[model samples]
Target: MVKRVGIRDVAELAGVSISTVSNALNRPGRVSDELVERVRAASDRLGYVPLQAAQQLRVGRSGLLGMTVINIANPFFADMVAGAEDAATAAGLRILVGNASDDIAKELDHLELFERVQVEGALVSPFGPVDAWQERLRKRGVPVVLVDAVDDAGVMPSVSLDDVAGGRLAAEHLIRTGRKRLAFVGAREEVRQVRERLEGARAAVAAHPGVALEPIWTSTATTQRGLAFGDELADRRPEDRPDGIVTSNDHLAMGLLHGLIARGIRVPEDIAVVGYDDIEFAAIAEVPLTSVRQPAREMGRAAAEILIARINGTETPDLTNVVYQPELVIRASTSTAR
Candidate 1:
């Protein structure tokens, strides 16, 4: 095997001292432009890749940011990751992504791992209570920014969509469309997002005395679980079924739509459906889905900015919390017209 080239090789090739080569690679601002260019050219010519860990150890802080999300498989979270990468790159920082998969223990594990790795900061879209973990990370000198979830206690900075308003919008749309028998699908009590959305739907239903709301809980907020719930609903007698349904996310909505179609139930005319997150699949399903749009990518970018500010000691505590509004996107699933 070829011998691995080191920084010493670059220094020798560039005719500079080892310290000058180090400065050029680790902290370019400290080195003169001429020396920096020469070091870079020598490094390129020799194909030398500096050890990031050693450089970070010398600098006392890594330029790496940690990001923990509930689920990366979801298109919504995937978009969030993309936005975060874009923003972190702009800030001259790199991001390490971890998926907690909606498990609180897994979420805590990811946080502990990031802390041990000595990341400068973290952006977390939590699965459960975050203040305790936030405090722990802060005690270790790692700043944290919450993503797509709020700190109701006002202790942690967060960037999230107003899920409650999104829920209300979904339910109110069904009500306006003349569907009175309403049902909410997915287990909202477990996740803050779904819970807040359920609260919003409750508020809307409370406003209309005639609209009775029924809630069905699912084991997970995945498409498979949605399909199961939809199958169960399909088994019910026609008169006993809900006239309108709102799901926790678009995955569930699409699965439920497929389940309904398999059972020969016509969409909109039979049962109107509304889903959250407005994922790409929502628009292309057999029946276009009506959904509540959360600005996931913008939320991720905003969270990264906030976390970077805190890491740089430039963030104002009072302005740490950022909440974006949700919008309703109507489609054939909820409307008869194309």
Candidate 2:
């Protein structure tokens, strides 16, 4: 059997007594900052889980719900988390967020941590395939609600957006506004949501004989990367540049929009831009972004309510897959009439 890392290992690594290690970890106020840092460093080096996390739950309960998200930096996930908290608070339960940091390993770790903490239920917005990891939760009799992702097995319920429809809407709007050469820009093609969005965009492109769609794979979805893409787009000859652009999210769209504008390219007249996820900053951008609205908060609230119901064994409506349709919001970026 593999030996578990004990507190003694941490103490020895930190060059402190076991009691000091315990106090530093469990009762940090009782120890000096230097000692706490040393103990923490040692614990980290040994891959030691804190005692609270290491210990299994007691017979009673933790009265807490665990939520895991792909990336907390994205405002959509942040809004969703707030919405979940709203439901959790109203239900008299606290919540713990386990940010996956866009890594599958981290997501799996979050699931295991939730099990150890004995959370009443878990909300998972998966970053990658998690069929096997979630099976463990099911075997433990712990309720799980898939947030923003549907379970392909049809066993667990989910609250999600119709990304395909969203992508189609964005592309159709650009085509209707008289854009012929269009490009879809974003990263993480391996992600289901991004891939499905592309599927819809291609469908729209295929319907029109003259219109063409080009897929631009990015390294990451960030304003800085968008800026780079925008600069590159501007450097191309006017005839070679796409007339309309559909981005996976607003961060890239906004950045690309600015990059184009800074290079004397006229939006709508020369190139129009459409972004996904109408985040708060979208409406307030320098040119006011046009985007596809994903009901992030509502999706979050719905997922939490369902998970809470499952935890309390309360009755709820059929939520096998609560899908929300996306809405296209028009703004100055794509506002020009044909």
Candidate 3:
């Protein structure tokens, strides 16, 4: 095996002190540009890689940020992570991504790992209630910023969408199309987004006389779960079935549409479907689905910026909750039949 290159090798090659090479790598501005270039060139030639642990210990900061998501397979989170990466890179910081898969214990483990690694801050889209960890993190002097999650304790900063308004928009659109019976298809109601969206739908339904909104709760957020729900709804009597369905996400909406079509149901002719989180698939679906578009990329950028500000001590430590409004995107799925 080839011997690993060290700072001493780079210093010898550049004819400079080891401390000078270290300063060039960590605090470049403190050294002359010519010397910095010389040290960098020598380091590149020697294939020297600085030990991140030692550097972090010396500076008491890692220049690394941790981000946690429920699922990375979802396109919505992919875009958000891309945006976060761009923002983090522009700020000269690196991001460490962790997927919790909706497991609270795993999420806590990731948080502890980030703490042990000495990450400057964290950006997280929590899977469930995190009140128990708030004090633990605060006691350790770790700054956590919630992404796409609400700040209930008023301690951590957060960025999220107005899910209730998004729900109301979908319900109101269906009602305007002369649909009275409505159904909401979503995963567990314990999720804040799902719960808030249902609340908004309820508010809209209450405003219209004779309008009824049915809640179709699913344990899973997968496309198969949506297909099953749609098939069950299809088996109901036409008069008893809902004319409009609002899905929690675009993936579910796409699956429900497929199931409805397979059951010989015509969209808008018999039932109309609308979804939230207007992900990439929404536009390319067999029938373009009307959806509420969350500013996912913007949310990610905002979360990164907030975390950076917190790390740099440029912003107040008080909690901040910024909720971006969701926009309604109209498509063929919700169009009224002529």
Q: Is candidate 2 or candidate 3 better by lDDT?
A: 2
Encode model 2's per-residue lDDT on 92-172: one tens digit a residue.
887899998778889999899988878889999998886758788999988898898888888888999998999999999
Residue-pair clashes per candidate, as listed? 0, 0, 0
The C-alpha stretches of model 2 lying farther than 4 A from their native spots are: 1-59
What lDDT score belongs to each candidate, Candidate 1 first? Answer: 0.89, 0.89, 0.88
Task: Write down the worst ten-residue block by lDDT for model 2.
Answer: 50-59
Any residue pairs clashing in model 2, and if so which?
Answer: none
List where candidate 1 sits over 4 angstroms from the true fold: 1-48
Give residue 74's error in model 2 in angstroms. 1.0
Better of 1 and 3 by lDDT: 1
| Candidate 1 C-alpha lDDT tens digits along 31-52 | 8999999999999999999888
Q: What TM-score would every model get versus the actual structure?
A: 0.88, 0.82, 0.86
| Model 3 regions more than 4 Å off | 1-48, 316-319
